[model samples]
Target: MKVINTKIADVKIIEPSVFGDERGFFMETWNQKNFELLVSGKPTLFVQDNHSKSKKGILRGLHYQTKSTQGKLVRVIVGEVFDVAIDMREKSATFGQWVGVYLSANNKRQLWVPEGFAHGFYVTSDEAEFVYKCTDFYDPDSEISILWDDPSINIKWPLIGDPILSKKDENAIYLSDAPKLSL
Candidate 1:
């Protein structure tokens, strides 16, 4: 696997090694030991796996859990998406800053979003399939959403008309007013 660092400190873009032949190709998606070595600082441990599919122009989140240690390792399995991870750690140097990555089946890139970051994605293809690993189980009560287009952290999304969003995301609060995570 090849680990690519983004502008953000802990955020990363990982590309798996693919071996192709006349028939097809094969690549290992995950190996606990290999993943651990690539991630900086403390070792990561995932407890839950999630998969979702969305149509073009669909935006999912700028969401995270405030009361739980929930880090995510996310990737796109089919189609393409403009994935984003925003730094919400109140005490960090990059607080409120966001980074965007282009993930697609052809590229096979994964984003490792550590605890204290809010994550979301925009489907740039006709349809998209996404999968992710979480360090903790879902906590509805603790889940918090920051408006995707919050002015305070204006994300330069490569938009294609208005994105379809869930009610929760549509009603999400601005980052300035949302509860801060003391990471």
Candidate 2:
């Protein structure tokens, strides 16, 4: 596995070694020891795994949990997406800043969104199957959604038209008014 640093110190792009032949291909998606080294040099335990499918133009986040804040390792398994992570840690140098990465089945890249950041993605293909491992359990009541197009964070979403947002996301507040996480 290879780890690439994003502008925010805590975000990372991971490329796993893939071995292929005439038949097909094989790659280890996760190994506790290796992942720990890539993150914080401590045990990084993922307590939950999630999978979601979305059609093109579907934008699903800028979400974080104020209580059970989750650190996620996400990837695209079927199509492609422009994944984003925003640093919400109040004391960090990159607070309120964001980074976007293109993740696709062909590239097989995974992004590490550390705790204290809001994450979301935009589908860039006809459809996409997204998967992720999370460090904490989901706490719906504690989840907070920030506006996908919040000007303060100014995310450059690659869009063909206005994004299709969920009702929660459509009503999300901007970073300036949203609750922040402290490091």
C-alpha positional error of residue 51 in candidate 1 after TM-score superposition, expressed in Å: 0.4
**What does candidate 2's lDDT look like per residue over 146-170, in tens digits?**
9998888889999999999999999
Q: Tens digits of per-residue lDDT for model 1 on 64-161?
A: 99887588989998999999999989899999999999999989888899999999999999999999999998999998889999989999998999
lDDT of each: 0.91, 0.94
How well does each candidate superpose onto the true structure, as a TM-score? 0.97, 0.98
lDDT value, residue 123 of candidate 2: 99
Pairs that collide, model 1: none
Model 1 worst lDDT window (10 residues): 36-45
